[model samples]
Structures are given as C-alpha cells and as structure tokens.
Target: MGDEDFLLDGRPHRILSGALHYFRVHPDQWADRIRKARLMGLNTIETYVAWNAHAPERGVFDTSGGLDLGRFLDLIAAEGMHAIVRPGPYICAEWTNGGLPAWLFQDPSVGVRSFEPQYLAAIEEYLQALAPILVPRQIDRGGPIVLVQIENEYGAYGDDARYLERLVELNRAIGLTVPFTTVDQPTAEMLEAGSIPGLHKTASFGSRSLERLATLRTHQPDGPLMCSEFWDGWFDHWGAHHHTTDVSQAAGELDDLLATGASVNLYMFHGGTNFGFTNGANDKGVFQPLVTSYDYDAPLDEAGNPTAKYWAMRDVIAQYAPVPEERPSAGSPAPRFEVELDRAAALFDVVESLGTFTAHDHPPTMDELGQYEGFILYRAEIDCVGPAVLEVDEVRDRAQVFFEGDGIGVLARTHHVHSLSLPRDARGTVDLLVEDQGRVNYGSRIGEPKGLIGAVRLCGEPLGRWRAAGLDVGRLDVVRRALRPVAPISGPSYRAGTFSLDESRDLFLDTSGWGKGVVWVNGFSLGRYWSAGPQRSLYVPAPVLRAGENEIIVLELNGVPHRPAVFTEGLELGHTEF
Candidate 1:
C-alpha cells in the first residue's frame, strides 16, 4: 500500500481476488474450489475466519477436520495464489452470532466490540490462540497471506475509533506483519468513520463500480482503489424467493469496474453449504432465519459447479488478467434414490436422555444454560382443565406447545403469534419446546440470547418451577441410546432409515417432502431443511458417506405425513432463478 498504488515488491499490483470461506465448504473440496477460482482468472483467494466455528467454546479451540485453517491456506499457496485473511472479533458475515462466541455474551457486563476491559481481554485471548497459526502465514514470512483485514465493516455497526484502534494494535502485537485494511460500504460517512489515518481503506458494493470507487478514492486520495466485496449474488432466507443477478448485466459492470483501473474481489466465487447448525438469520422488523444453503447465487453454485455466471465473469476478467487455458471440469451428478424411514421415536420419549434438566423458578434463556445452538424444552407441571390461552412473552424463533402429552398449537415469532389456544386441558406437565433458529447476525440484536425469552404465562398467570432441557441434537451417542424402534406418532419424532451406496459421491437430500428439522447421515449432520419454500434440499458431501450401507437419522420437529427419505442428483432448491 502506497500513495498511488498497492505496491508488491516496489511495483504496483492490482488484486484480482474472490471470496471463498473454508468453514462453509467441505475440507475435501478445498482444492477443487480454489482451482476453479484460478480458472476464473483470479490471482488471490480471500476468506473470513469464523471465530465461533474455531473457538466454539471458551478455552476450547479446534483446528482439526473441516475447521482446519492452516490446511486451507496451505492449499491456496500450493496452487500458486495469494491470500487475504479477515480474522474478525466481529465479522457480520451472516454467521451465527456474527462469528462471536455465545459464551462471550454470557456476562452482560462485558460490552462486546467496544473498549470494555472484559471484552478486550476476551479478544486478546482469542488473538493469542489464533496468532500461532496465522503468524507464520504472512506474505513476509514466506507464506501466501498478503493483506490482513481489521474489524470488518465497523462503520455499519458503530463509530468507536478507540475500539478499531485497539483491534489494529492487537493484530500488530500478535506478530502479523502484513498491511492492514478496513472495509465498509462506499460512503463518505462510512469511509471516514471506519478507517484510521494510516490504515488503508477499501469499499464494498455490487454495482456502480465507477461511482463507488470514485467515492472511495475521494477519501483515500493517495491510495489505490479497491472494491473488497463485489456482491455478484445474494443469499436466500427461509421463505423468501431465491435471489439472482443478470449474468450479462453483472459482467458489464465488471467491465466498467476494470475499465476504471480499480482492483476488485468478487464477494463469493464459490458459496458453499452452511453445514450443520451454522446458518444465521436476519431481523429488521421481522425475524427471518437464513436457509441451509448459502448458495449466494455466485459464479459457482452450492454444489461447487460452474454456472453461466462463471464464464461471463471469466471473459470479463481475461481482459484484465490471464485466465487458465484449461476449463473447469464438470461435477458428477448425485445418484437419485429413496429410503423408507422404518424406525421412529418420539422426541418426548428421548428428550430426558439427551441431557439433565435444570430447575428454575422462571424459565431461563438458552445463554443462561450455556446452550446456544439447538432446541430447549421448558417443562412445567400446570393444573388446568379445558381450552386455555397459553402465552409466552417472547418466543426466540419458534415453539411447539404441548399440554398433557397432547399436541396443542405452535407459537412462531415470525408470525408475531405469542398466544395460542390449547385444544386440550392444560393439566399435568405443560411443555414448550423452543427451537433456536439462529441468532441475528447483524444489527443491535446480535448478542440477544435464544430459546424462550422473558416469562411464560398460562391464562394470564405466569408459570413457575420449570425444568428446562437443552437438546443439541448433535449428540450421536445420546440420540442413538434414546432412539428406539417404535411406531411413528404425530408431532416431533426421530425418523431413521438405511441405504447402501455403490460408491461415495456428492448428494443432496431432497427435504421438500419433509417438515422443518435437522438431518444426519452416518452421524454427520447435513444441517437443517424445511418445507418452507426457498431451500428444498440439504447438501450431503461424499466424504460423509461410504461404499457400504449408510444410515440417516432425521429429527423432524414438525411431523410429515410420509416417512420416506429421497435423494437427488441436483439440488432442488425450490424456485430456480439462481
């Protein structure tokens, strides 16, 4: 970074980069995705380090399996490409808790992303743990990492200069020698607020490349112009229509951007699956949880296959940089099959075996129990007889109400339904099974806990002495121990089946026929799927499968009429605009 250009070894360099998150994609497919980026005429591959995924719990950090950060970067370097690492204490990349660990917010006193001592101390602890892996990967240290990013998009969140300053200092103290940069939308207020005097500034936008970069250049008058996040496609919400952008229109914009002699990084060269319970949500006035597939409608689809957009962008980039002579290889289609769910077990039959319940006078939120991601059961013994109004002050996302071992009704936050009428008597044990769809990944609601919030009331009276149980559902042994070969009753139950594969390959579990729930194959969670329009299938990578017989267990939260698990060669992601 210099007065006029981004200098690499005393010469001006334009970064032709594309974003591809390693956490989102399967570990086995990292090389394939990176190679495809090179095929698209990109010289650099950028990614964000998900703090929540790496350090899921405090004092417990994992870099093994799919969460291997070092392996991802080494693969990029092996392929002769540069890297940009954005390790954010607050990323806001539509991830769970915006990549902030849930335990960090347990103590309300610690003001996160601010200059608070407790919060800063936690940030320091995280950086200290992460530094060992990232320090040796910097470009100066014979590694591929060229530029390291500071707190991501701080201007959109808050304008705390001291907070941003401390973050930069922390990175430097950890021995990161690469040049630092701050990204924000191309606006005078954002560019001025997010960037420090010496830190290089970059803008993030999809269109109007000439104007956005001009806006960026005005603030960074002496530096090279760059669009850090060129959002060529968009993500899909649970019920919203699938989003797409015109290929020709986007390519024309790319031409206009290249014509301005500005550097650009496509926001997503490959948008992978939000595997397991890692998908996030958004809430403006309405709360909308993000679907299982990140897809993003990028050049590469969710299955990592090149689309028309890939060639369109490749042609545009060829004018600026050299593209590979060889084209990308086509992916093998998934085999289509259907397996009958012969075994079934009701959730209530196994809820007790999952975990022990905590006794509370008033129902506690998910954070209070140190349970962040899954479903929590708040059971209370209530004495009543016929139809009554059951009210939960706030349902985090969705709740299924049960009274005296009978299915009553559901209360959903999306529909603004807090009160529902119970058809049966509110006698014996009254249960409210709450599901944590996802934490708000952006805005002021980021740190708010999941599960049942506030008081639980029946007939205008608050319920007390509740026993709450957390169902992570990721516990294979517990679920295996609890699941029995019983007849399938209505409501929430575990549906199980087995199928044999001749060979292992990428597959998609068509979940359009099923209701809302999570799916697991051979104990590896394929993430969540819903009958709710947009996303109709869950991506199952071949790595999770074997040549022999394979088992799949589905925890169908809302019961479906049929008990058949279907497979598809391609993703049946509802509406097909992307």
Candidate 2:
C-alpha cells in the first residue's frame, strides 16, 4: 500500500487507534490484544512505553519477563495494523510520578517534563537508548509505526514553543522518521504554541462537539483533523467511587465521528493496571492514587477480557470499516492454586519493643530529601507541661499525631496546617505520622513539591531528636520479608491451591472480604487494592498463570481471618470501593 492510500487528499487519515500500556496486560497476550484491536475495526494501536516498566531500576533496563517492547511491536505488525508510539520519557497516564522512576527524585536537581538542562540530558539518554528499538520499526522502514507523539497533552502543563520544539527536535535527532503530532484540547493559543512543521496538530474533543472541530479547522485549517484522545471511559482514584462512562453513549459518539469522516483514537482501548508504584495523581491539589486495577470500563477490561463495551464498539466499528473474519479466541489456560500457610500475623504486635525519642528539640520537615512520594514518620518527645497545641508548621500534606501512644489529632494539608488542640500532661512522648499521599499529576503546576515540606512542633517549641520511618508499602517482596509482622495462620489467608486446566483463559482474584493491600502470584506483584475506597479486587492475567499449581500471596492491611477469598473464570467482579 502506498503512503497516500492511508491518507485521503482533503480529509484526515482514517486511523482508528486504541491506547494499551504493554506492562499492564500479559506479554503472551500481546498478539491476542492486537487481534482484538483489529477485530474492533481498529487499524492502529497506540501505546505508552513506560520508562519505569522497562527500566525499573535506574540505568538497569529489564526487557525480559514480558516487558519486551520489540516483541510487542512485532505482534502489532503481525496483525497487519499500524502503531503510534508514545514513548514518553514522562507519560502521565495515571502512572505513579507520571511513569517516572522514583529513584530519579533522589537527585534533587531533576525536574520532569521540562527544559531543565539536567532533566533534558536524562531525557536525551532515554531517547537514544529507546530509539534503536523503535525507529527501525517505523512505517518509513516498512514497519507499522506510523506516528510518534511529542509530549503528551502539553496544553495542560505549559505552552512554551521552545520546549515543544526541543521535544520534536530531540525525537528527530534520535532517528524517529515517522510523522510527528501533538495532542491537546481544541483551543486557539494551544494550537499556535503546540504546532510544529511536518507535524500534524489534532484537537481532543468530548460530547460530539462540532464546535470543537470548527475551532480546530479555523485555528489550523491546513492540519489534520483527528480526535487524539476520545474519552470512552474515565479513570478512578483512591477515596473516590468507581467511574463508569455510558458505553452505549460512547458507541453513539464513535458512530457520529466515523459518519463525519473523522479519525478517532480511544483514550484507552484497554485500561491496564498502574502496577507497582507507577500510578499517578491529578493536578487538583488532591493526591489521588489510582487503584491497582486500571479497568477503566473500556472495551477490554484490565485482564484483557472482552467487556460489553468491547462488543458494542466492535459492532460500531464494523459498520464503518472492515474487521477480521473471526475475533481472536482467548489464549491458553491460567494456573490456580491454594496453599495453606503456617500463619499470618500483624506487624505492630511482632516488634520486640518500640523506640522512644524526644519531640521537643528535633522537628521533622518535608525538605529533608526534597518532594518525594509516600509516607514519613516522625517521632519526638515534648517538654511542655499540661495541654499544648500540635503545630505542623507548613505541613505540605497530611499528618496524624499521637501523644504517648494515644491518638491526638489529624490534620489535612488540603484544609489546615495546624491540627486540633492536643492534651499533653507534663512532658509526654509524641509521635507525628505524616503521609505524602502524592504530588499533583496534571495541569499547570505539575512540578510542584510533594510530601511534607517543613518541621513539626508543639506549643511554640520545635520538636527535636526524631526517628524517620518511610512507609512505602507497595514493594511486595520487601514488605513481606521485612522484620515487621508475621502471625500464625489462625484461620484462612487465601492459601494457594492449584487446579489443572486443559486450556489457558482469563480469571479474577475475588478479594471481597480482605482489606486493602497487594497480591502476588508466581512471584509477580499483581497490584494494590484496598477495602476502604477505590479498587476491591484485581485482574490476574492468564499469561502470568501457569498450568500447574500456581503460588498466590495476599497482603491484607486489616487482616480479617474468617472471611475466605474466592476466584472466578472471568473479570466480572462487581464490588466497588467508593
């Protein structure tokens, strides 16, 4: 096929694409996923190459264990479909620190998604490393890679043309030959600032707004008209109810787009898990940690199962374009097992003795290591006699204070810096627990400092001689093996039990009764879920499950022993964490 065949003379190229993060879905399911995309009449598959996923440790890349981007691209090509690579040095797809490795924050000089010299140098290294794997697969090289996105949704951050140009030039210098594009809301100023030569500018629209299309046409009349990110569903954050967009309504909107001769890309064809500490927050000043399961109520659920939305979208696309003769069948069988553990215990009860410190002289500040994600514990003793006010001067985030092993008060940074009055009787020991929650992930002040920034004090005296405890509980292996807590299995602990199956298929780990924590199978950390608010259960991909007895471990925060955890054959658990 010729290049012109893909793009019409007057109209924009009719590219129906879907965004799927490679790390979320199992590596074995890559081909099946691409086939499913094609079956839904999708010609192109857009994906974000998560920097953290490929390079979990700084300077140490792991393309093994289902993270092979080359293999993923090959699968897309084998399906005879095009690919749009969004290899964001920083991809804020609700990923932790916007797909950035937390270790990067260790260096106080590194600022993200900007023109900072040190930051740009790191970005250049990343591009140079990733270019060889992707550039050769570009459509110009007879491969399926058609377009490369510069920075994602830049209008929400900043409109510096120089910054945008730097990104385009950086990618081009690293040998990306395909056409380039920028995705942003349909606006006049954003259009002018985010546009580049040889790069098409597309507007992001919602609710079938022809006015948006008119605005894009009026602003950049010569550019391609496409919906870069069509919101088929929404994402869920902690402490928020599960979000569900009307799939039928979304299908209708998609139909309207196809009828109007517009090219559209589903923001998420399959919303996969944030996985590990890669989940991100928004810019609303609220630290919204995304649920472990990124099942954004899309066509393909987190486990790669076809949802009702999937069929609806498939039928809608069939009306406009030619799909495959038969949809790809589900892949091989997944391993399931139950193992009775010796016992499970709480961490608080296992410690031999708790350490004590003075809260009068040593004050805890968020500036110790700069703005990083997670919780920081500060312990100190107060010398004041009688009742005193616990003042967390400039508490950048949230703080929970306990005086003499008694809960004193709670202060939310979103609300007030100083907590309520604390009743202290003649020089008592005090402990201040502060959780960073997370930095804002989107919008203008994306580079704002996160976590606690200043010191904690009481009654006009700075707390001194403190012990810092970092509570980054998501690291499964580290947390499980820590010298924290382990108890004898008094009752049930979702023990690993195995059953054989002739063929591999999707399955769901029902976490109905368990409290919030992480789940691991065959040594792979599935993701984090909480009984409080947000995600209740998790999607276990079949590729990760084996034919024999598979190992499963559950780390419950609350530890309810009587209630038994269950499993199902498909991804249809209905419990919401609202």
Candidate 3:
C-alpha cells in the first residue's frame, strides 16, 4: 500500500474498491454482498470495523454472529478479493457514536477524538482488544487485509498531531504491520493535519473535480494518487428529501478519475441497512436525523440487488480493469402481497422493563445517564392553567408530551417545534417522553447529547423535582407473550400481529400513516420509522422468516389510529426539492 503506485507483491495494482459494512448487512448475506461488489468489477473491498458493535459495554467484546470479523474476512479472501481495513476507534460511517462505544460515556468529561490522556487510553484499550483478532487476518500473516486506516477524516475536525502520531504508533505497537493511511479533503491543511510522517495520504471526494485530484498530487507527489471515498451516492435523512446521485454523471466521473491514473474506491458500492438503532444523525448546518435505511443510493440497493448505477459502473469499470465476464444473475424478484395485522398490545404493558427510573432536580441528558440509543422519559410536577405553554429549553431530537398519563403533543427537532400546549389543571406530574433518534455522527455537533438537557418552564415559572427514565429497547421479548390492553393509536403503545407464509423471501413492512415508533419482527428489531414524509417501509430479510409463522410488534410513541399492514409496492423514500 505504501509503494509508489501502490505495488502489491511488486506488481501494479489498480485498487478498484467498494465500501461494504459487515454490521449493516445480515451475517448470512456477507458472501452475497461481496459477490455483488466483485460482479461490479471491484477487485478490492473496504469496511469500517465498528467498535461499538464489537464491544457494546466497557471491557466486554462480542465477535460472534454479525460482529464476526474473522468469518467476514475469510469470506472476502475466499472470493479472492483484497481488503482495506479501517479500524477507526472513530469511524464516522453514519454509525451511532461514530463507531465509538456508548459505554465510553460512563466518563463524559473525556474529550473524544483527541490527544487527551483519557481519549488516547480509550482508543488504545479498544485497539488492544481488537488487535489479536485482527492481526492474524492481515496479509502479512497470509490474510486478506492489506491496508489499515487510522482515525477517519480527522482534518475536518482538527489538526491534532499528537493524536495522529499516537494512534499510528499504537497501530504499530499492537502488531499492525501493514501500511497505515489517512484520508482528507485533498488540501494542504487537511493533509498536514490528518497525515503522519510516514503514513500514506489519499483524497476523498464526490465529484469529478480536477482541482481536488490536483490537490492530492500536489501534496503526495511521490506516492500513488487515489480516491479513498469516491462518493458514488448519498445517504437519506428524515424529513429531508430522498437522496439519489446521478448514475450517468457518476459513471463519467469515475472514468475521468481512472483516466488520471488514480485508484478509486466507491464509498458504498452496496449500501446496507443500518439495522436496529445503529443509524447516526448528521449536522452540517441544521440538525438532521439519518433514516434507518442506510441504502446510500449506491450501485447496490439495501437488499444486495444491483441498480442502474451498478450496471453503468460495471460497463465503465470493466473497460479499465480486467473484470469477470460471468456474473451472477440477479435473483428472482420477491413477490409482494398485503397482510393484515389481527393482534395488538400496549407499550405500558411492559414499561416497567423498558426503563430505569431516577430522580433529579433537573432533567439529565442520555450521555449523563450512560445511554446511547432509544428514548428517555422526563417527569416533573408543576401547577399550570389551561391554554398555557410549557417551555423546554432544549430537545435534542424528539419528545412526546403527556399530561398525567394522557398524550397531549409532540416536540421534534425536525419540525423545529419546542413549546407545547399545557392542560389547564392543578399541580400534577408533567411527563415528556423524549426519543433520542440518533446523535450526529459527523460534522461539528458530533457529541451532542439527547433528552431534556435543559430546564423546563411552565408558563413562566421554573419547574423542579424531576424523575428521568431511559427506554433503550432493542427487543420487545421481555414482554413477548405478556398480555396487555389494546389502546388507541395515540400515546406510547405496542401493537402485535402474526402472519404465516408457505415460502419466504425478502420483504418490506409499510409504515405509512403510522405514528413514530420502533418495529420488531420475529424477535429482531428493524429500526425506527416516523410518519414524517420519507421512509415508509422497513426491510425485513428472508432469513428472519420461518415457513409457518411470523410475528411483528410495534411500539408507537404517538397516539394515532393506524392499522398494521404491509404491501409489496415500491418503497416510499422521502424526497426533497433541493
């Protein structure tokens, strides 16, 4: 990876690579994803090793199931494709906490992505745990992993040399013998800030801009010029329009970059789903929540099916690289049908198991309580008259207001709504069920906390005596068969239904006209959905289904009349005019 022109085994290697996250796709679908990339003419594969997915808690690590890197890499090697491993203790791959574990917040005073002793120690500890499992798979040890990336795109954040130097040393100290690389904006500032003394430098861009490539050449003239993250497509967001990159333009730009003799890596040749609450939010100028479907509008759709973009890129890339002529046929399209949900339940039936109660003078944020994903409840007693407005200083994501166990209104960051109408009544408990959709995984607002991190005022008076609770339900099994009442669609409620299929295939559950909530099918959580105009269907993989029966449970936070139904029609991806 370090040689001029990036010679591998003393031979010229044009790294036609594509990014594919193992955690994003199901464990059973790893081979299919890599096969699709290879069929698209990609000779190399790229992936970010999510630290949080591997170790959800402090001092604990999980590598079985979807977190199994060894099995994933072995599959890649078996396919005869090379690998570029990005083990960023800080991989900003639209992952929750930027791939950093939530348990790290047990000590919030520690500044993240910095040279602070605590931050460095945390990174080192994570690397130490991962190194043993990772090193044996490196090419040096006859594994497929050839190149390792340090902290991801750090120059956009700051120019911390000690941090970069220390991380590079740590990789080496932990037996990473492969060449280490750093990617940046292709400018002198980013190159200087993100690059180490001996590390290779690569440019990241989404367009066919000559100036960007020139900038890379100007800085790393002695080495191979490559586009580490040649952004072939984009990620979608809630309330924002669905993102779709022009495949024609992308194909032309890819050809242009290859003509310049630079190796290229498509950011996501196959965009996978951000299953569960693993999706990360974004903050460029406004706070936007990332959709559950990481479908990145890439060459391959979320379900490992190729798109028009995939075909276009394949035609152009085959002209440059010696691609395979025999490609796998796109499997038979899955049949679509309507299924009626006949059963139901309420969320309060299991609220006891959903959250841990705590008392506070003021509401605390998710970070304050060491929680990463899911919702939190804030309750305080206050006297208010009818038609009065309740002012909460800040709502990081979304909140549902409840007046003495009755749902009243909602506060979401997307709509920029803050104040909600209060009921005219005597002093009572004011409950705010706040949902931390996701923390911004990229940009300046990277570490913003969720929940009511500020004061609550009733009309004009400060309210006191608060109790906060957290609801991070990844599964609804604790009360799977627990019987509860079937309440209205409004308020926080859980609905249950069962459907049977003689045969199984990939499917989507339409959530249109439904309130915001989380969906669980056969004990696996599919992620979040909001009625906010964009994503309306949740991707349910085939393996999760059985021959006889299937079950679905929804925990909706808002009170609205909605029936559980699914259709095979096209997905309702939200669209924006811009």
Candidate 4:
C-alpha cells in the first residue's frame, strides 16, 4: 500500500467489495451469488468465518457441504474477484455465541478474547487448523485472498492490546502473509483500543461517511481509508418491524464514501438464512432474539433476487467502476402449495423414551448438563396445596409449564414473566420445557447460559429432586421414529406431513397460522418460525426438496391450529421500518 492509497501492481487500486457469508448461503448458490456480486460492479467479495459452524464441538471440525470455506474462496476466484477474509474467533455477526464454539465456555479458566493461556491456546488451535486451507489460497500464493483481518471489533469489546498482538503472532505463525486489518466503529476510544501496531485500521459505519472516514484518517494517518461494514440495512427480531434503509439515501451515502477516494464493502451483499438454531440474541436491558431470517434487506433479498436497491447501488458504482452492460435476470417465481400435518406425537407422552433424564437434587442449567442448543426439560413431583404460585428463578429465552399433562401457561424471559398461578390442589409431575432461543451475540451479556437457572419454587418454597433431560432439536431421530398416525395432541407436540412435487423449486412455508415451533423438511432443519411478527415464512431452498415426495415435521410447542401449513411463492417479512 502507498502512503495515501492502496496499491496493486505498483498502481493505485480501490477495493469495491460486498460481504456475503458462505455459511449463511447454500453451497449450490455460492457461485450464483458470487457471479451476481461481480456483475454489480464489485471487484472484491468479503466474508466472516464462523468458528462455531466450523468447529461445533471441542475436537470436531467440519469443512464440507455448506461449511466449505475453501470452495467458497475458489468460487470467488473463479468469478475473477479479489477476496478479504475476517477469521474471527469472535465475529459478532448476530450469530450464536459470536461464532465461538459453545464447548469453549464449558471450562471456567478460559477467558474469552483475553491473554488467558487456555483461551489463547484454543485460538491457536483454531488458527492452525484453518491456516492450511487459507495459506494455499492467499493472493501471494496465486489465489484470490488479498487481505486477512485480525480480531473483529475488538475495541468495542475490550482493550486488551496484548490479545490483539497474540492474534497477529498466531496468524503469522500459520504462514499468513497478506496485510492484516482490524475493523471498529469510528470512535476515538474504540479505534484506539481495537487497533494494533502494523494492522490497517478500518471503520465500520453506515452514515456520515465523510465524518467517519475523517475519524479513521486521524487514527490511520497515511493508510487508505476503508469502510469495512457499510450497513445498507438492518436485521429483524421476532416482535419488531422489518428493517430497511432508504434506497436513494443509501446510494447517496455510497457515492459520498466513494467520492472521498475511500474503499467500501457493503455489510451484506446478500444475507441468507440463520437455519436451525444458529440465530443469536441480544439482552441490552431486555432480551430479544434475532429472527431466523438473516435477510438483512440488502440489495439482494433473502430469495437471492435483486431488488430496486440493487440497481440504485449499481448506478452509484457504475460511475466509479465497470458494471455489466446487461443487468442480471431476476430469480424465477417460487412455487406455492399446502401440506396437511396428519400425524402427531405429544412431547410429554414421548419425553421418557426420546432421551434419558438425570436425577438432580437441584435443577442444572443447560450448559451445566453438557447441553448447548435446543430444549431442556425439568420435571419434578410437586404437591400443590390449594391455589399456589409457581415460579422459576430465571427462564432463559422461553419455557412452557405443564402439570399433569396440561399446559398451564408460558413464561418468557423477554417479558420478564417467571411466575404463574397454579390450579387448586394440583398433585402431579410438573414439567418445565425450556428452549434455548439462540445465545446473545453481542455486548456484556454474550456468554450467559440458556435454560432454567436457579431454583423452581411453589408458593415461595423451593422444589427439589428434579430430573433434567436435553432434547436437542438438531438430533431428533428418535422423535421421527416415534411418530405415529395419531390425532392432534395438545401442547408441545410433533406433527408430520407429506407432499408431492413435480420439480425442485424454491418455496416459502408460511407459518402465520402456527403459533410457535421449529420446522424440518426431509430431516433437514429450516429453523424456527413464530406467528408473532416480522418473519412469517421459512425459506425452503430447492436443494432440500425432492422431485417426487417430501416430508415436513413441525414441533409445535403450542398446539397446532386446524389450518394446514401453507406455502407461498414469495416472502412476507411483515411491516418495515427505516
């Protein structure tokens, strides 16, 4: 890089890039997304590596299918575009646990993003495993990768300069030769704390491009200014309105950033699905979990179709860079259909055979029981005398309370409701099925464990001798096997349906009628869908469907309504707000 500009082949070069996470999009569509990105007048594609996805378990690491990082880079190179990689052990991309493996926090001595020996050692192991794939694909090694990022947004989290230094050393030790970069919001304190010696400091903001870049210039001095995360739009939560940014205004901001001779990367060129239980939550004052759709309302919509915003942004880019003469074609219309959930199995009836429950004198948290994601059931023999109050010390996310196979009520952490009135003279086993609705991905509440924490009380008296069982929604083979041709059951039941299709086409399963539950198609999880608000349909990619017949299973925590599961040709993300 030159004193005031980025240099390529001894000449000035500006990086026009957009962020599209490979793990978020289907592997079959990676090439399609990359081709469209190139057609949009971009020269580079950037992505954040999700550590939890790659290394879900402590010793297990996966790089095949959707998690294939090498193939993603190859696709970018094939599109003749440069690449920038943010390999954060902590990437707060609204992902579960900020991409840190859940098992990493099981150890008490390991301090996250610190100089703690155990944490650093874990980071080193991850980098060592990841380097071989990236080392051979770097730009210096005749590959597309041009820049490698250090810890992501470190300054916003902590001021451990030594930790940043250790990350640099770890990358170098892994044979990474590309220029290192760090991203943070443009603030004196954050930039100073997140920045390290010799690493290019880039700002992450959506507005005030000139002012934000000036702040970056003050810190970077001689280096070329860049906006690593130009957030075009925002993500949605369950109850909130869908987020959107003004097309004209955002395009003008892009023009302003480019006018300053600054490089830019659109935060989400195409935001895809959170699929399964990978979505994250936030707890700043109140706990709000992210919706399943990671569709950040970008230029490319969740269905991979280019929107009006795409063309406006393209016009802005065309003034500065080359774009395709012919605009890309829109995606084909999605197919619509309906499937009736005929078979059913109640969770309460099959809980005993589905998994084993360990007897505990006191209820243990999901993490304490070695269970990370999914629901944990706590059952105890409670003798209710007269009208009494039932309370749990804390309910992480949400929980459904049952007594003698009857769902009395629901307690959600979001509303801070933990107690309910029980029936008079109730005597039976009390069941509390707590669900992990994605871990917090940002702020000081990042690592807070899920499930019921502390005591379960009846009339202000603590209950004991509880049996805890983990019902991992991801591993539901037993539940599938246990399904029978039965009538609709009440409360927290699994229902199955089958439908025939002539061809595989992208479709949306509208869950507006259903209360709350997770959906699985042909054994592959499409993630959770709630009738609450914001997102009402789950995007079912064509790849997960079969040519002839497909089976869908819904674990409706609340009883399934009489209406059939409807499918739509388009997405309905509810009301939008700026």
Global lDDT of each candidate: 0.87, 0.66, 0.81, 0.89
lDDT ranking, high to low: 4, 1, 3, 2
* Residue 137, model 3: Cα distance from true site in angstroms: 1.1
Tell me each candidate's TM-score. 0.98, 0.83, 0.96, 0.98
- Candidate 2 residue-wise lDDT at 303: 69
Question: Which is the better candidate, 2 or 4, if ranked by lDDT?
Answer: 4
lDDT (Cα) of model 4: 0.89
Q: Go through the candidates in order and give the C-alpha RMSD of each one to the true structure.
A: 1.5, 4.9, 1.9, 1.3
lDDT for 522 in candidate 3 is 89
lDDT of 4 by residue, 1-578 (tens): 88878888788999999999998888998998898888899999999999889887777779999999999999999999999999998999999989888888887777998888999998989998898789999988899998999988999999998999999999999999999999999999999999888999999999989999999999999879999999999998888899989999999999999999999999999999999999999888888899999889899988788998899999999999889887789978777778888787777767877557999988888888887888899998988788879988899979899888888999999899999988888788888989999999998777778898888899889999999998765446767777788675788888888999998878899989889989999988999988777898999987888799899888898886656778998988888853
Model 1 misses residue 385 by how many Å? 5.4
Per-residue lDDT of 408-505 in model 3, one digit per residue for the tens?
A: 78887777787887766646777888888887888766666788868887877777788887876654666566635454444677777788889776
Worst 10 residues of 3 by lDDT: 482-491
What does the lDDT read for residue 372 in candidate 2? 52
Tell me the RMSD of model 2 versus the true structure. Answer: 4.9
Give model 4's TM-score versus the native structure: 0.98
Q: Give one digit per residue, the lDDT tens place, for model 2 in 387-454.
A: 78776655645566667656566676655556567775537666555655454556644445544455
